[model samples]
Target: DAGVTQSPTHLIKTRGQQVTLRCSPKSGHDTVSWYQQALGQGPQFIFQYYEEEERQRGNFPDRFSGHQFPNYSSELNVNALLLGDSALYLCASSLEQGGGYTFGSGTRLTVV
Candidate 1:
């Protein structure tokens, strides 16, 4: 069985552009979390989805958004991107109740 999976392993975007990164949770996982990790910094929580609804969010601006599908997959969308948005976007999956998370290798997004 595969763990979490992410697409477009690498990407580059310009200021004001929009980007969407996708993730598929591991088997038996129904919750998904998104995080952003800048160089030399730990991952910062962006948001979490369960039952197709956003359950929690971090300190990111409104430009960050996400969605969970019935199949437990999720997508993170960022709009009006800025240079500060350049970072490794990570996707983690876990049980809704609570447990250790399985993380994808992450999608490296560079906002030029």
Candidate 2:
């Protein structure tokens, strides 16, 4: 079965623009998590979704939002983008009962 899948492997956006990144979870996984990874830095947790509700969020500002669908697919939306937002956005999926996570290749977003 396919692991998590993310869309638009690379993107370029201008400041103040908005971007939506997508993720489809692996088979049988019911939870999805998003992360942002700057160059030379480890991934920082953004938020997590389960049962179509945001279960937890990290230290990111309100510009970041997410949604999880019935099928366990998810979307990460960023509004009023800033150059500092440029980074590799990662998607991970795991069972709600706790298990190892499967991550996607990640979407590379660059804000100018």
Candidate 3:
């Protein structure tokens, strides 16, 4: 079975702009979650989606949004990005039961 995959291993942007990152879940998985990890901090959950609807979310602003597709793939969109938004955007997929989660290497977004 295939594992999760992300694109553009690295990214660069400036304040006030917007960006989008993509992800594909591991085979047999139906839920996807997005996380942001700072250089020295544990990943902070952004949101989770199941059945194409956001089932749960963390303390993230409306600027952070996502979408899940029938194929179990996902995309994270951050609008009005700020320097503080610079971090590793990770995508993890698991079953609705909250097990078998697999994380992607991540898309590094650097804000200038």
**Tens digits of per-residue lDDT for model 1 on 15-92?**
999999999999999999999999999999999999999999999999999999999999999999999999999999
- Model 2 residue 51 lDDT? 100
Question: lDDT of all the models against the reference?
Answer: 0.97, 0.98, 0.94
Which stretch of 10 consecutive residues in model 1 shows the poorest summed lDDT? 94-103
Q: Which stretches of candidate 2 lie over 4 Å from their true place?
A: none
Q: RMSD per prediction, one decimal?
A: 0.5, 0.4, 0.9
Q: Summing lDDT over every window of 10 consecutive residues in candidate 3, give the lowest-scoring window.
A: 92-101
- Residue-level lDDT of model 3, residues 11-95, one tens digit each, is 9998999999999999889999999998899999999999999999999999999999988899999999999999999999999
- To one decimal, what is the Cα RMSD in angstroms of model 1 from the true structure? 0.5
Extract clashing residue pairs from model 3: none
Give me the candidate number with maximum TM-score.
2
* Over 4 Å off, model 3: none
Q: Ranking by lDDT, best first?
A: 2, 1, 3
Question: Model 2: per-residue lDDT, tens digit, 17-110?
Answer: 9999999999999999999999999999999999999999999999999999999999999999999999999999999999899999999999
Can you rank all candidates by TM-score, best first? 2, 1, 3
Clashes in candidate 1: how many? 0
